[model samples]
Target: MHIHTPACPCFIIPSSMLRKLAIQADGAERQRLLEQLERSAFLRGQRAASGLAAPGLLVAPGVRHRTVYDAHHGTRLPGKLVRTETAAPVTDTAVNEAFDGAGTTYDFYQQILKRNSIDGRGMGIDSSVHYSKRFNNAFWNGRQMVYGDGDGKLFTGFTHALDVIAHELTHGVTQYTVPGGGLVYDGQSGALNESMSDVFGAVVKQWHAKQTVRKADWLIGAGIMTPAVGKALRSMADPGNAKLTWSGDDQPGTMRGYVEGGDVHTNSGIPNHAFYLAAMKLGGHSWDKAAPIWYQALSLLHPDATFADAAQATVKAAELRHGAGSGEAAAVQGAWHEVGVV
Candidate 1:
């Protein structure tokens, strides 16, 4: 129950990953991991500072306001305003990436999903880059986006991958779009939250690339990880890689693989792969068929829904959108069955 507190920072780098990195490192690298752990604690404490705490869906027509700040390697948020929505590009790599990535994500939501912004009310998208020394992470923090430069060992710049940026901001969408101010960020519900971000993250990435389902790499955090980290953060097509290796490239694809407690990041692979299958089987652009079904499922799902609940929701979503016994609905059901969610 403590998982979804308004204060919980929905970190993209799972705590388990930090612990693993800390365990695998030695000497100076070990020291870097320790520093990350310390900084992460402080981030948890300040995550709720966003100031918008209303529950239930609030949709209003606002503007697509975006503000990017530079933490200047410090921990402060909305730090120094380096770029506004109309400002010319600065000479910094992180700033431009943050600004561009946020705009692309906003475009995906507005253009593809037909939602105004994070709140579907044109709520401004705010982001902070270069947070702390070798911070090694990025997150939604319940309000705005916060990014970190990796320790230069296991990962690269968080902004290097537009999917990573879209992934975090989608958390804000997940939090605000649900009843009771979003589902509890724990257990099955929390895993769904993670999967939803991955779902749209993949969608936005594909949409930006103009890639169809067959053409898309179907990997999350693809360019974010350094070549040293064994290739990307997670793979939706094959969960075996994630389950067999500590490097975390894939995840478990069945109900038996569910991480008992609330390991949202690790356990999210099941649903992630389910969506992947649905998209692949449906063929053509993911945003056209799979994304709409999943987006509709997000509204249909109960806040604390289990994997079974999600399977049924998406199946029902497919049936509703594509007809009761249409191929689309069957493919969705088949996708859930492949993941063992059925």
Candidate 2:
């Protein structure tokens, strides 16, 4: 005797039919499926939203004027400008260095890439010096760039280095473009974002200083840090090493060993290494070849792009802007592969 199992007509749902049922389902069983569906849908929404958030609101276009304020070393309580009467007069060294660096960053976008300002609008470039007593870092606080007067033991003043200022300000540029919603600050994507800033920061310095690839120091934050420490904040050429031996390793040497969990600042070394390799291979001023490709990629590509995505975008941009077989394209391809971006 053969026992025939009858198919439950209601349960005989086709794979495609199930989707329709899932959408139309109601009551307890439907609610259960919908909950699962809602969770998945929410996750997707998050990913989509992640791609759209502006890193920071754009201030304006074209580098404008600089306004230096004195934060007075206190985290809270607004401070006044360092007028001669209010505080020690703004030192000539501080004024000139800050002016030149901000100018170069402005010119970099204006002359080369034609970006008006951090947001493609003529945003006034504001820089505040003597931010806090013994503060150790400089940052682009969404509105403007703020520099700290280093602890004097670990850092002098952020304004001391043209590249350091450029680096901080470029963070605003990154904010306006991809924004990354602070999510990209981790993993390979975060590393690439960090490296992009370093790439632009170094290029701004080299372009202004007229340094070729060979002459460029390939170090970020070279002068801001204290002399007692052996190296700069980071080294593009040899990431795992510092300019000064005492500063410890600068970045992760390989992709396999990259620091995970979106540590924006720390994990940036991977892409920094790729930029150095690409610039060196191209054999010229970094701004001349590498900067343009990176800028184009940043502006036109997706915000949540990973290191590999960036590498591929750079390769594509170079090819489209230059030629498929151009030296720039080849360099980008090779550099990404070398850094394990492939």
Candidate 3:
């Protein structure tokens, strides 16, 4: 299938969060965060204008290739090539982390989900680390991965967190898997897009750690942010709980708390919580059943699919993968009900 790639890139950090943090911050830090926010807006415009995928030669299935680059605190993407597959690890922590994280994410999809790569066609993974000075965010810019150093105060760095890397990379997977190019980057559809990444991001992390659903932390972007800022970016287990996540997290886990026009990140908590509920109910390694069911549902979605559409797709996927009236299907249905998606 020819997957239509979307022009817009998906960022791990939401602009709303940046704005909130900026308002609270003072001095140079505030200015830097605001600058990053402006850069993010400019990036959207820049990417929309290009309307092109990451330019590179495609490889066949079963061939794993990952390339890492150093942006050297510049705006240019996929900057100078620093490392490649099979190469020795470099001294730069960000470079090594980017390479290793991509490798692990690639392995998780190939070994567990039976996917070739982000595009399921052995498309080479390209990443750039240290993107601009204290840039404060990471993103999959339609074509390649870009990591920001982040202000040391709030974020230690982006590339070092495995879940963070997987989260950004799964954005690429969603772009290729979903029909109609990709999910629309606004409204409920956009929230679902973010949820998909969060779901697979946590699954990839748990799979790598050999952690079962109960044993898993269920926190996205953990260890990426400083403890003073928050435990993580968001919590799948309990969304909108400031104690579990950060002070500024406004994500709602159920329909009652749903915001009419919330940011994609905020609204994603609904689907994220649903996936967590489904996974916990299944009671096993997430990659075994829950992940596969969700992964299969990707092809069942359209660009503008609603929350109800996704709920139905997941229920159908569980039935198709397991059986009619199977436990998997029931769990998925009940999860959607719990989140009021049905």
Candidate 4:
């Protein structure tokens, strides 16, 4: 069945956060925030106009094909081609970061999960850096990655952070992996979409660092935002902890504090925490078991799958992989129960 899925770019920084920061700021900073927010909205419209992907997708066989473009502080996407898969590092930091980050994310999926590229085929990875002047976000536009250099005060730069890059790219992974073109970007399903990105984003970062679950700092988008704004975007280990994240952090670790109509990024903390709990309980490298189980669960999920559905899917994935009464299955179920999902 061909689902006409609207193209909603998954942004690394949520719009709500930008709005909150804008409200707190004044003069030029506030104006900049508002302008960026406007740009974000405009981009969403532009993506919709560009059209969504039709079902029954086809791509090249699984081979790592990466390319980086320089947006040159303009709005146009897949801008000036600067780097290719075989090219050497360029002088521009953003270009190099985009190139390398995409490569690392691709490697993590291919090597760790034994999956191909984003589409489970050899789909080319394209990234554009320096998109718009002092733009404060990075996003996967259902096709490629686009990043903005931060306003220097609020955000440093998008490409510098590995997890931020991985998070955005994984949105593409989720897009092609999930049935019906991708999870609908709202409510519980949207939260699951965001959580999927966060899960693999954390896993990729951990795998890159060779860090165990205990050694890995369960933070996303670390060092992207200015320290004054926050430590990171969210804390999987202790969601909703403002001190660990930022003053504006309001993610709930479990269902008791679930927002009635929360932004996907906000409610994602529930499943994000569940994944963290599962990984910790499994007690090893996150990529070892927790991540694979989650990866497998993607194929078993529908686009509108809820938190409860995801909980069951992961538990089933565990049982399928390790056995009906295995430690993996028990841990997976326990993790969901702890999060009040099942």
Candidate 5:
């Protein structure tokens, strides 16, 4: 699904009366409100963790599995399985696309990364298709990857693209490894996480298609958008210039125009640009060298890593894998400097 725009109101404000009440009151009232917000956030995290804590449905032992549901193509969430372990035949193109995308992601992890599943523990791969009628965004939801058949105007089914599927699944990998990592879904750290997912997402696609760096498009969600929509979600090669807007431009390529604090997806363009530059500078299939360095940086580094930290980590990985003054190390350093990551 394509969330061209944010699904929810994006922000919330406390009642004016409550704010005024707290301002007038002493310590206890303000503390109570603060505590409430903290508690609410904690509860939400707990609930998401609980959902992901167990395997949703085991279709097979390893990462390969398939199942389908009608989804009724409406605005209701998939609450429970209408039928379990029953194969709802791939009746349409959308279902087939989802199945293929899921299998591709599973294979990428198993063969390339050697990760059994999202958590590297042979966790079940679960997906719900035909979700909410006209639901525009596909999400991991901390458990299953849920797909939506688009409104048919701006987007088709999200499952059409393998990279998008892998992208969502990588979010699970981040959660397990960087649990409670202080990369608030905004600013540099948030951008790093977003870029990390894209890096792996594109790598999986490249590995699956056997495309080299010189041959890859380096664009995420290349096929998801319908002919009507003018652009893909975001471009790693060129961030701000990826789309032409009806109103005005959406992103700023450089750090000068970078919005320091925003949602992870929007602010991610900075680091994404850095990765693209790094891959191009390395001058080979992205998955061959650049991807491994980045993966090692992500899995081994601190959770609160910044762009500079990531740059250094890649340099370190290159030095260890190649040599201190190797071409890959120099390319990584140059790319970060080009993007102002240093």
Candidate 6:
């Protein structure tokens, strides 16, 4: 049996936001937004042809091989090498940010999760910064991370936020870790894929800042957007606050809020909040307990698992890790129920 997964680029900025910006802008700005929309469509077509985002390419083992490339404000990829694993910092901020962001993401998975790298194979982490002129998005292009300077209106630079980098890279992590090779990136499972990235993205930031559940803001892509777009792209702590700064969040905290098999990023708010609730109830560093349980649950998920199935899997994962019927297990169950997923 084969699942027709939406083999598409995982972008930090959702299409809806971009479309809105495009419709509202004028003159040169509108043209740039239209160009971005077209580029995104083109990328989706490429992914559909390629089958996998990160294709099966064997990488050297043992070394934390990392490289940063400069796109020079053009569309070309894997551009000029600007930094390496052992090089000095460059004058370009985007170059340094991509370099440092990839390194930090690698360290989090390596040190906290005990995973070697994106593939757990010590595979090299690479990134391309300043991709295309005023590109308004960042994404895991199936093989590498690409950043845009953002038009400075709706969005700012992409590399400044650790979680944004972590979120995109975690898509690579899922490409390697999910059961049956990967989850079909469509419908409910597609939403779950987005949610998983959000889960780890928030955890990475929390883990790095040494923030406990209460202290963590649970905001994704925070500080990447201009002050005009609100506080952040998404809020796990309160999904309804996802678009507080823009047109207001449409994310619902329950299955009733599901948008008719719509945008994965929007539908993800339910599960995002579920993870937040469980982590909050568990009351500790997200990485220490919540992340491990969610990670373990990732392996158990059916490739096409629905919201109910995922909720059940998390409950099972918690029970497996913290003993059956334990407080942790109850918390997982309670969290799902709170989010109306159970």
The lDDT values for all models are 0.80, 0.63, 0.89, 0.89, 0.62, 0.84
* lDDT (10s digit) by residue, model 6, range 18-121: 88878888998888899999998798778767865444344554456789999898888889998988999999998888888888888888887778888887
Task: Kindly report which residue stretches of model 5 are placed more than 4 angstroms away from their true locations once superposed.
Answer: 1-52, 55-63, 66-70, 74-89, 179-183, 242-249
Model 3, C-alpha of 286: deviation from truth (Å) = 0.4
Show the lowest summed lDDT stretch of 10 residues, model 5: 3-12
Q: Which one wins on TM-score?
A: 3
Model 5 C-alpha lDDT per residue in residues 1-342, reported as the tens digit of each score: 211111111111112222333455467546544443443345345543443355554443353554544577643445445323245544577666666777787777776666677766666666677766564557665656677675565456688878888887776666555534323344566566667777788888888888877788777777665655545666677775635321122454557667755545655667777778888888677877888777666655555667777778778988887899998889888888887767
How far residue 219's Cα lies from its native spot in candidate 3, in Å, is: 0.3
lDDT of 5 at 273: 74
Summarize candidate 2's per-residue lDDT along 96-132 as a digit string, tens digits: 5665677778888888888887666766666566654
Candidate 4, 1-342: lDDT as tens digits: 766343477899999999999999999999999999998888777766765543223445446688899989998877999998788999999899888889899899888887778888777888999899999999988788999999989899989889988898888888888877778888999999999999999999999999999999999999998888989999999998988888999999999999999989999999999999999999989999999999999988988889999999999999999999999999999999999988
- Report the number of backbone clashes for model 5: 3
Which residue runs does candidate 2 get wrong by more than 4 Å?
A: 1-63, 76-78, 81-96, 179-183, 243-245
- List ranges where model 6 is wrong by over 4 Å: 1-6, 53-63, 242-245
Residue 106 lDDT in candidate 3: 90
**Model 4: lDDT to the true structure:** 0.89
Write candidate 3's Cα lDDT for 151-232 as tens digits: 8899889988899999989988988888767787789998999999999999989988999999998999988888888989
Question: TM-score order of candidates, best first?
Answer: 3, 4, 6, 1, 5, 2
> What lDDT is reached at residue 61 by model 3?
65
Clashes of 6: 2
Model 1 ranges with Cα > 4 A deviation: 1-7, 45-63, 242-250
